[model samples]
Target chain A: MSINRNENSKLDFLLEIGNIGSGNALTSLAEFIDRRVDMKAPRLEFVDFNELFGSVGGVENVVSGFLINVHGDVNGIMLFLLQNELASEVCDILLGSKLIDLNALDELHVSLFKEIANIMAGSYISALAEMTGLKITTSVPDLAIDMAGAILSVPLIHFENVFGQILLIQNSFSVDLKEYNSSIFFFLEDESIAKLMKQFGIE
Target chain B: MGKKILIVDDAAFMRMMIKNGLTQNGFTDIFEAGDGQQALDMYQAERPDLVFMDITMPNVDGIQALKNIKAFDPAAKVVMCSAMGQEAMVVEAIESGALDFIVKPFKIDRVLQTVSKVLG
Candidate 1:
């Protein structure tokens, strides 16, 4: 049973998984920060690299990004992006003081953000792994505080040989009362997509 | 409440949080390591009563450190700590001689409870 990637059913299935993963990640983040982390429905987009960067307020948008290379049954790159101000706000909550600037985040601040990304992405990846009965793990994660375009190019370039269009799951979340937008891009190899679809009996 | 404990994590913030919790609960003989290599070295050097080690880290990870510590002393009481989605690694840790597992974003009470049970 070969699954058609463009089929509406396939899109719906991936979106559902995205929703579940984001929900679990949000719950974990809320607990970690002790704040009300609310989320909007997850959106799944299969778009060109240029359009992908545009989705996150264009590639020039200055943001904090965390990149993790996912391994095991699911082979892909997982990226978490956060607005600079929102990154600082979360750091403030974690550090119990004001984070002067995201651009000037010191070693401690970098470690804190990396840990937060670990909790969030780990929870989300765990949900997917549990649901599919696949063994999944992530690298230690690399952080980039730069323009969205510059940060996103890392994953896009890494998966360039495997994918023409990337699967992006956009999540909108708010911490405390400040609205923040974040995105998670899952660059699954073709075989990985097939494996996931087969797990759900879609193929 | 004099049980010596070691906290291993790459994040200074995480180590500080766990240390603060353990200290507030009266567990004073505590040590910290930034990565698994440090964890293994510190475990042999400090001989802490119990260790709370995060699973993912640079250079060496928690599971490897657990294996190293156990090989040195099978009677070592070690607990693996990780984020929500690391069940596979958690199982591996337990199989490798870890006494328990703790998830991140953990409450202070949970950390204390695990310490009490493991040290007891």
Candidate 2:
């Protein structure tokens, strides 16, 4: 299947997939916490490299991030990020205890966050696979709690010469009257995006 | 003593969850491996009656481990437990000799039923 390579069409197709992926993530998280997870409409945008760090509250914002490589029929990078305050609250709920410090996360806390990343990203990829009839697998997630710029730079630096804009989804969801924000970034080259669109018979 | 079972996943929390679930239900003999390589070694060392394997890991993956264990012991009973529940993975695991596939965020009852059915 040959993709038409129309830029707007490609962005539209990606936006559609982003909606599905974020929806799947929200549903999965709700089931994980066994709570009502309500999400605002996800914003899918293509941001230039200079604006990328600012999208997540500047380069120095301390946040928890997880990166997982997606492979098989379609290849890309999946990133999930949460601010430190939200991360701490989430840890409290997930770990079933109040955490005194977000700076020092025990191994168990890290493992839980990694699992959450796995589950959320896996849910998105699973939905994509089911919809496109493609085989998609994810790597075990690598996590970090650092400045947003530092975390975002990993992919940016890797694909600096290859990609001009990064595809990002800003997802906001509330649970039990507390609002939490997260962002999922997909770093795929033009060729990969074309390959993904081709599966949907988008011409 | 119940039949010995092995749980393979990189996440310690996940291993603990499954372990707690099984122990609460009277399945006392449970073993754990952090990755596929460890799973292979533990499988050989413990000769666990059933294995719950995760698909993605660092050193080795569940699919490769499942293949290795099947090669070592054709009678091996393995079930895939992972968050990646795509059709392709499920089919691949089954083709590679997995007896069953259990998607993550699963219910304890479902895990118990798979264990009972496979071990019985």
Candidate 3:
């Protein structure tokens, strides 16, 4: 749980990268939703999969969800959560109509979240790629309705430290009218971690 | 001549955001729509030279609206607006005949640049 001096530096690098990525994501969200979003970069932590799951009190229901699976020399995931009202507001903004119904889960809602996630994650990964000189490609974002638990329950087994455990990076953000929370949970294989450390000039 | 632009998105805040970007860049006579259905109706009525459209909504989506507009105006100049992680849909929009795409949390510079390019 406690990172050493060298590891601390590496974490700092990741945090800085995450900060830029989050900033890019926030800017995109603001434009798309037409609302100002307050974004915060939380203190970075390294936790085993079990500890991560236990710390967050598990995933909860959300109005809209955007998730991107990041793959490359450095591996992890980026997730964006939006409250239903906010999601409807975003849908309204995007479609150019006030007719968006915020109360229901429908195909339109799912597609909107997928689009938001795509833009946010794409902007984040592009920023990261620029910083690290790495090529990153994300999977086609999957849409879900009231499926946070289903998505979180499925374990990510990429990291060797906790095979089948989910290592989570929890972060928070808020839009003008509503508050939102999101996380990036991934298991990095030892090789990936080693490469990440070396890239950060920690090795 | 300055291009006539359509702003479609349900949120007033968002409509204002795109309107600000366009007006600041000297794009006047901008029109607005709240949903995909309205967007289609507006396309038929006003037939603006350009559109900055959001991808998600209640009655219809940006993609569907984009397709509908394109179906009506094969020469329609439509730009898809999306938040993060909607790359695939963006691609679909482009293939469906959108002139280009813009990602949101709108950057003044990015929006201006995309508009200038499309107009040019």
Candidate 4:
């Protein structure tokens, strides 16, 4: 589906906002983990279910997931992904345990990821709120452990190809003296992007 | 101003890490609890001057635990130990009567600063 000129502009605006939000999250991760996190802000896009599911290697091994559902004048979903290994590292860092078993993926691990997702998503949402002058309230992030494909199979009722790109954030963080890599996918709707641009006073 | 502080978290390593940081900064009377219920029990017996509570746990999560503790002592000085992405819960905890919060993967300086700031 092709988005109109106004929608296209909005997409760009939202993508930029996502980048700033993700950047702030990365900085906090770096401070907590004491490691540098590398991120790439690709153009946002709208993908068919098949293509979207295929992009993240089928999401079959996804150990833990966090979702920040956005509701407002505009809407979309912000997803944080951590393969089992990375998820464990995050747990270890927050809990200060080098002996934590990555394979366990226990309750503490899930809870820790939920908190991390909250921070990352909250930072992003706060930035959006400041720029748009709108109060964005995010639901308690829903936590899931499923195959990547299964998770992707869940439909996004409000999907839009705002920027014609996907903001893929790659993070390398360490905890318990171990290092791991993870990524976050942010899908922005075209209308949301437009609202963001107007809020930022971007031409 | 010397005050007793309680540290509640399931992870022994984390409790030790925070204990080490706090004690080094002259917080001599420190107590440890593995979960929220344990924290409440300790709070009743110890009447600690402050608390460092973790948000997630098996028996009772941090936020609920915070509320329970606050119900007993509205003047409870609890500092939440949060991980990333827990901003909403942190806000809730603060509203629920926590004095402040500290993010996990505890930074030595930040922990000390927060502890001193809150305790003072």
Candidate topping lDDT: 2
In candidate 2, the second chain superimposes onto the true chain B with a TM-score of 0.97
Tens-digit per-residue lDDT, B1-120, candidate 4: 468999997666567668888877777899999888999999989999888888656577677888999999988888887553344555677789988777654578877787768776
Error of 1 at A3 (Å): 12
Error of 2 at B64 (Å): 0.5
Backbone clash count, each prediction separately:
1, 0, 37, 18
Residue B63 CA displacement from its true place in model 3, Å: 19
Estimated TM-score for each candidate? 0.94, 0.94, 0.58, 0.65
Please write out the lDDT profile of model 1 over residues A1-203, one tens digit for every residue: 22365677666777777789888988898999888988888776776666776778778888888998888888888888877787778777878777776667777888888998999888988899888888888888799999988998887766677765466778777787678788888777778877988999987
State how far residue A187 of model 4 sits from its true place (Å). 6.0
Q: In the order shown, what is each candidate's alpha-carbon RMSD?
A: 2.4, 2.8, 8.2, 5.9
Q: CAPRI band of model 4?
A: incorrect
Task: Kindly list the per-residue Cα lDDT of model 3 for residues A80-160, writing each as its tens digit.
Answer: 545556666665666655435544545555555666776677777767666655555565565554545545544434333
lDDT ranking, best first:
2, 1, 4, 3
Please report how far candidate 3 places residue B82 from its true position, in Å: 8.6
Count clashing pairs, candidate 4. 18
Runs of candidate 2 exceeding 4 Å displacement? A1-5
Score candidate 3 by TM-score against the native: 0.58
Instruction: Give the RMSD in angstroms, all C-alphas superposed, for model 4.
Output: 5.9
Q: Fraction of true contacts reproduced, model 4?
A: 0.11
